[model samples]
Target: MSAKPLTAREAYQVLRDIALGVRTMRRLGEKPLTGVYSGMMSV
Candidate 1:
């Protein structure tokens, strides 16, 4: 069976959610958490 299509608003909301998730992942990945751990181990 074919799925129903989303309305314009639904499509916009889905795009917005996807953009937000990508931004969050980018921000988290930008942080150098591994370096912090290495520094802690050396001290």
Candidate 2:
């Protein structure tokens, strides 16, 4: 969201939001968000 890097808490919040959104989408029968999880793990 910015040119600068996120702080640890900010990063955590962002990731948590993504996970929640992914879960919600899952309930709606969307595809799994392995790309996002894998990207984070790779980093």
Candidate lDDT values, in order: 0.51, 0.53
Off by over 4 Å in 1: 22-43
Tell me the tens digit of each residue's lDDT in model 2 across 1-43.
3357789997787678778774232323245556655332311
Best by lDDT: 2
| Deviation of model 1 at 34, angstroms | 33
TM-score of each: 0.46, 0.45
Clashing pairs in 2: none
Query: Each model's RMSD to truth, in Å?
Result: 14.3, 8.0
Candidate 1 scores a C-alpha RMSD against the true structure in Å of 14.3
Candidate 1 residues 1-43, lDDT tens each?
Answer: 5558788997677668768774232222334665534432210
* Best-performing candidate as measured by TM-score: 1
